[model samples]
Target: MHLSGSPTRPPRSRMPRALRTLGNPLEWTDIQKTILIFFPPIPFTLFYLYRVNGLLADPTVEPYISRPALATTHSFLVGILSAFSGLFVLWFVLRRREGTHDLFVRAVIHSWFVLMGLGAYLVGPFSTPVLIGYQAGGMAVFLLFDVRRAAQGGLVGLLVIVGTTILERAGLLLYGPVFSSVVFAGERPPDVWVYLNLAFTVVLTAAVLAGTGLAMALARARQEEINELLATDVLTGLANRRGLEDMLEREITRAQRFDAPLAVVMLDLDHFKRVNDTHGHRAGDAVLQAVGEVVASHLREVDAAGRYGGEELLLVLPEAELSGARAAAERVCAAIRALVVEHDEHALRVTASAGCAALVPGQPRSGEQLVRAADAALYRAKERGRDRVEVETDPAP
Candidate 1:
């Protein structure tokens, strides 16, 4: 007999769908994301420029460890040039092109990190810790890669810091004629300084990453809300004309591809102007809203209804033939007749006239053509009598 085996461990839960789809920073639109990416470098570039200007104004100011101020000045100028070059390329060259924009953004970020690392080493030991910390934070914010790529980028940044420190020490030993030539030439900083620098780098990097992530997430959410608002009718809680047109186009494409039937119904409130004159505009609005609710409630899941304009509504029904469309229009007409709106303590009842048209196979039917046919039938229904449904006859060859 075999011995009993140990229990198997449970499988790990997968990441949430939203978190899994958190896109790369480079994938963001060039306008806002690119501007934000370049923000961190602005402060450092300004600081360097200020320092260089001050040193130039007062040439008698003592150099750090017998190193000339000109070397630091040159470093600052290089950083400013790099920052301007990146911005120019983004605005002028990349413009609105996403593919090249993404590549350019990533390249600029990597180059900025390299420039900052080199500047920190050249600036001397006294300022190395601060520069390295800032560089680490900036990299964490601007890299905007996925977890694996971000981790690799972070590792590269760490290597930059450590390698710069080592190279500075070597230069000191070699008596190189540069900024901080004498100070780091002999001895390295204390181990406590190194530990403190690492600690500061880690803390700042975490803060920048978290802050950037939160801001980007909020911006994305706001954009979605704005789009929804733009596509919605404020009064009827239905799709606006523009939104309706978009849905109609998509349904038309699907119907054409599948060789299925598609239908549209155009409805107009009967004697709507009389109601506005007898009661008031507010009462007319209430009637419109009531009509919207009735039409929406009567529609099937595959159908979409939207406000065509004042006193009018349109419906799109996919996979529906002419007879089916006429039945749907009759139901909507009956539903509107049953709706009662209360405005200023007045009970108002309204009726709608509808025209139905269906796609004819082997005939090229467009959204505009279908809508115009329905409108013609609607005009006929009104000419005969209101509160009825009329179906457009087949188009002649």
Candidate 2:
């Protein structure tokens, strides 16, 4: 069965030691991207503010009206306000769990680009090339997302550029008097210089896109490795206890929503401590691994099998009634008993006891309650002598 949740909050105490040393990778990556999205404009805004202050301090440096310093000041303030406001909104949404991190990241990046593009347009053509380059670099950052999302961002950026260009051209045609006074006062650079600048921007964008793509691929690969380590039992290659908890929670919700049958089987190797005392710990590990494989082989595709701690495993069977769960538990017990693990040239055979519990209609129980019932039955199976399956007794009305 498939398990889904926010990657940011993976199960605790299940991650590999190495991964733990690095902290939550998803959260770290999210923070980094958020900073990249919101922090880059601060320096530029500060620089413009500094320049505006200088211009006001001494008008001889450049006439305020001619230099469009006031317009630059306004754009810088708007950018700072937009960045902070967006950051606060995103942080609030994340805290509320109302949206995905990636979704918020995309929104922030897109809005930043749109605002920057508008600012560039307002500042007129002399500054457009440099700002356009910055916009391209911002587009390259979309690589932090998946290929499809990156492509979507790229398309949106292209549309914004085209639309802004068209509007600028149209303004020149329809409102020449007003547009010329605002945007065309500065002496335009040579055509060669403009084209050269555009070419440099394109080349820089391509290089950044390639680098970002590589970095994203590496990050994704590392995340997959870490996820594997977190979810799997090192000894048995089965789902670990934390993974089982996650799966159980999801299955519980699904069953409750659909009013479907669900069962939990708690299995424990009998006389496991004795086995370890008789044989070495390695032999005990081998036996546990064999049992894990046997249990997995006996389960259906919709069933989940996991290691629920030392010498103990759990099975979650969705859409399985009491009888079906009993049968499955019995089968698992038989399979585990039949398992043979060869250690130190000795064929060691092991047996397991299992307890089965199923959800009953009209009786509401949480996933933990189901597991507790199964565990109680498991105790009974142990008391009844190992290598058997016991179903939890149903409560009377």
Candidate 3:
């Protein structure tokens, strides 16, 4: 049965879907929805590589660019294309093999960032706008990969750009290495820098487009983080009541649309008032927080947990039936009985009673009705000597 994930950590599947800024392009982070090695679509990368190849290949493009620069750019493009082609061929041959795609996914994408930086530097002088390549490519890396990989890739990539500019300034390497006779004034290219300007402008345009896309992605991620923070409970680190109600409504809609099963579990602490009376409110708060953690940890990635109220929690399971919901509540009750929260150097113990309710397709029941049923079952658990599990199978409001 499907269940939503806990509060602190969202499901991996949901994380990727939430990043729908690029039309869900290139789930490079996860192997399941993985795209072509470095780029999302194969044609997009091929077109980008070939476009650069054409710029360097045409003598009219750079207007009498040097032989060394010509050969160097040609060789670089050839190598990049060949490497990508070989991988595609390998993937095709082993297409039917079970983990073949996994091997291809390890394709060193960030390394290409450094290579792009080096390549962009070669085509223009130190003052050329192509320098934006580092920033553009770095942002893309930061978004596509995780933090550690992003930092590592970005560090080396920036070093390549900065190191090359330093070398050119020191006369150790030729500025405008790709344009043989291209010379620059202190802060800008010289008057005879017409053709070089054209080439650099093209590179700048590409960088601008890439940077803009990455910036939008950054905004989307940040907004999502802010939204999650607002939804979370300050004390329990679980979804607050509002968040739970929102999730319940959404789950109910999904269940209705897809004819899927839906379940809710309402759990309340037994003798919670007694704990506060004996240990004080601060310690009682600690107990609630600890219990919330336990509940969040016990559920699957598809299970949703939230703080319903003081000493009470709710769980929303997407594809669970009445029996599954009942069993899940029982497991939760057992876990609570075994839990120990240490506050003020004292080992405080607590027990929980839980009630479950579920829905079938075309049940004509609302999420509120489902919650009320679970609440009724929870009251029954309390009446039947507490610290137990109960279920309400009837969908009637």
Candidate 4:
């Protein structure tokens, strides 16, 4: 047996703190990131293979000298791709061995750092559009990882790229290794090189952005769920005390601004302790939950209710005058008196005493003052007799 409005849903199971960080809120799974690690190198390797076959260059328009130069350039690009692929395996190996994500992540952080640096190197002399695109999109990986170590690794990678460009400009290294006057054995036409690099840059950036958008959407949804859990009352499905106070403050501001009448009604279940003592806490809870429904059903959309504490609820009614507020509280009292919560084989019932306090418009009154007035009147109702309503006479703004 259960009360009419008591929450009966099973409680949400909480994940362990460590497991929670793995994917539910923010972190991508190791498998997902591992696939990302594999994808980056494939395109670069294929592009270099195409270069080895002169598929990218127009031999009629570009300079061609030695076969050895083309082979050397192809080897260098392939080497970078191979190095990245070979090292990326550590992310998998260590992930299996340790099963501690942070341990594997820290182990592979430097590998990612080197990959980013080399990725920038392939298109960088600091001024290349492809390098700029890589930097913009590459930051998404760090965002997905979101460990402090990831940040440190990414920063080191960026610094190496920047330092490399500085050194290249100073003639310590080649400026635009692939973009310089004679690229390998044959120089591709300037416009062809530009178009190809631009295409690469666009594809690279778009992939990163698409992945980040999906991951961030998941994180944002989880955050909203957490916020709701923090603010809502699990038992009555109303705002809790803290959330109610915040609402009250905002309503007070609205009343002053729009010259609207506002009233606060504080309701306390009569003989609540006796219900717990005689019928057990479960029955008392049933009584409270049923009464919460009684108060909620009496309210309009503009009205708000919250559990102020045990066996007590506070309602905020907007655009309500003193008499209207008192009448509303009486209705709530009548409704609570009618409630019959069926617990086990017994039919438990409850009654509520309510106090109404209206806002004195154009007066500098705080939310606390309004609640105190209603609270004081609530005690008066109790003193007079249980199951009744009382209106506060003193505005005391």
Candidate 5:
């Protein structure tokens, strides 16, 4: 029989594709999405081992006397169950579709529950101090794993402690053996209930702090991206004037400290306006893009390149001398001459003129002076009939 009133609607499996795109599904990377699935219940298995070791280490403990072999066998059974649950998690991560987000939510919740349950079972019968430490350790782990949304885990951890406290209280009121374990040691009964409450408070406080710190970190990352956009040029993806100045100031100090050479290359597209008039503005933009790409190819990982303004571009070459800077400029000129941009079914070629200047060691100069020296060399290249690299004879000292 059809479940819906309208049989023409067909089954939900045949629903429109548009309806499926309404909600976003959370996704994880390949390693996180695959390998973690098979290892979900690993913590619980280790907890079981710890519990067995605890009992074996001291048979006079309350847990050993209460049930002895039964508790040991129960822990081993939980370990076996965890192994199966791990297999299920692996299958869910790989094959589950259309509800992957919901499955992730459920999986994380289930993992949290198992950790809390294991922790409570392991430490609940122990002295107050040990139980408090155990719960604290669990809270720390949850914070490290998922600090952004840690409140949910914190609540689960609190519930586990509360459940343990209720059981201990009931045991003390009902059976004398529960009280004998704590009080039998001394006059002071170890204050198990107080310790549980303190642990709960500590976990809750840590979760709140973690959430606040995560939010601040995300905010700082966004701010850095915005600043980068403001300091960068949109066209050639190079640093604008502001970014160039910042780079110069930063590199100057390093050059002074290490006594290394630093050089600057100022380049301009020769007869740029003539090219714009002869071809078109679109062609001019293409020429600039091609030149930027060529120069970028020659730059090392530590160097910085940027569009200064209009047809001019700036290059900062650290640990380079005047001769080295001249060589780099020549390479840049050759690279630009080779740039061929496809435009209107024609391969358009362009050439660039370059000026090279090196910073004097142990001599300080303003950023403007350095730019002016490079700019003078650029003009010299233009005066020498363009399309050539010129090195400044007198650089700033």
Candidate 6:
């Protein structure tokens, strides 16, 4: 024997703030951006390798104390390190965990910077001061902890490449002039510093621009979604009254200008109150939603269906004559009466009535007149018996 009493507690159902933020609609777009982050590094590494090889092929090119083999080795190691950093990006894609992906990407980018500093140790030291300035500027912009963190990341990345070139040259400089004589044997190879500056400038600029474009696209997408939510009915996913009115006015103007037929159909669920009282409000809601689906499915793509009010729907059919509109409205009524939705393991059926009015040529058929004519015909359908379609004819044309 069990005793029944009021429940002691309310249901504990709620999502935490952190989880909500993480599951924000924009999160997937950020994931899409991750694919682009790894692209610039590939070309950047290749360009750096090109600089290293350009020096190595020259007979005068020398590594720390005329060690040509060490210079080549340094170039190979830098390429390998850059390639490794790029490969780690794939892991981030596969993982697809936002927090972990951000953390890993940051670590890889920072580590790449550190390697650039190490690469400078292999090549000959700086000749012009501009090259050093390039490295410093890149390091400052990309690695700087500011609001534009990704821009900073790219900047740091470019600087790291320049740093790598500088590190190798600086290494040769500290070692001796023989190292310089070997690397710069006959003529300087267009100052590796110039190449470094160009690489950082071009790559970092592109990265920042690309990030900005992606951010703009995300914002645009959000605006479009908000507009749709405001204009669409949540239950039926059709245009709301405001949206319907706007569209109707536009279609009416176009039809009048072109002398094309425009039709309006106002539909209401018949005996809707009886259904709600007999079953439940849930069942009535189901009936309304199912009728909406049925009506939409029967209509052509050119026609617009909107939820006008409680248990009432409106259809705007352009380039359709009175006959065509009436036939379409009749079909919609039949479809709604045929619709049976399952509720609480029982099949429930409902009926709807429609009233259609068409704009005739040489008549001032405003949107208000068309809708009102349809509404009056809809009342006639209800009077003559529900679940039938009525058309307004003999209008003062």
TM-scores for the candidates: 0.54, 0.54, 0.53, 0.74, 0.57, 0.58
Per-residue C-alpha lDDT of model 2 across residues 1-397, encoded as one tens digit per residue: 1111112223345444555676443445553456555665565556556645654465443322334545555565666777766786766557456445777777766666665555555444345444555555555555455566555665666576567678768775222111223322468744433553465456545655754665565566667768877888877778999989899989988888889999999999988998789988877877776776678889999999999989889999999998999999988887767667777777788788999898887687887888899998899999998789998987311
lDDT of each: 0.68, 0.68, 0.71, 0.71, 0.63, 0.65
Q: Give the per-residue lDDT of model 3 (tens digit) for 188-280.
A: 654335654665557566756965775576566656766887788877788989999999999999999899998999999999999999989
Q: What is the lDDT of residue 341 in candidate 6?
A: 74
Count clashing residue pairs per candidate: 1, 0, 6, 0, 0, 21
Candidate 3 — what's its lDDT?
0.71
Quote the positional error of residue 63 for candidate 4 in Å.
Answer: 4.5
RMSD per model, one decimal: 17.3, 14.8, 14.8, 5.7, 13.7, 10.6
Candidate whose TM-score is highest: 4
Q: What lDDT score goes with residue 54 in model 5?
A: 54
Any runs in candidate 6 off by more than 4 Å, and if so which?
A: 1-43, 58-230, 393-397
Q: Residues 238-320, candidate 6, lDDT per residue (tens digit)? A: 78898899999999999989999899999998878987898788777766666666777899999999899998999999999
Model 6's lDDT to the true fold? 0.65
Q: What is the lDDT of residue 178 in candidate 1?
A: 41
Candidate 1 residue lDDT tens string, 54-95: 545554434432335465556656666776666766566566
Model 1, residue pairs in steric clash: 172-185
List the lowest-lDDT window of 10 residues for candidate 1: 1-10
Of the two candidates 2 and 4, the one with more favorable TM-score, higher being better, is 4
Relative to the unseen true structure, what is the Cα RMSD of model 1?
17.3
TM-score of 3: 0.53
Quality of model 4 by C-alpha lDDT:
0.71
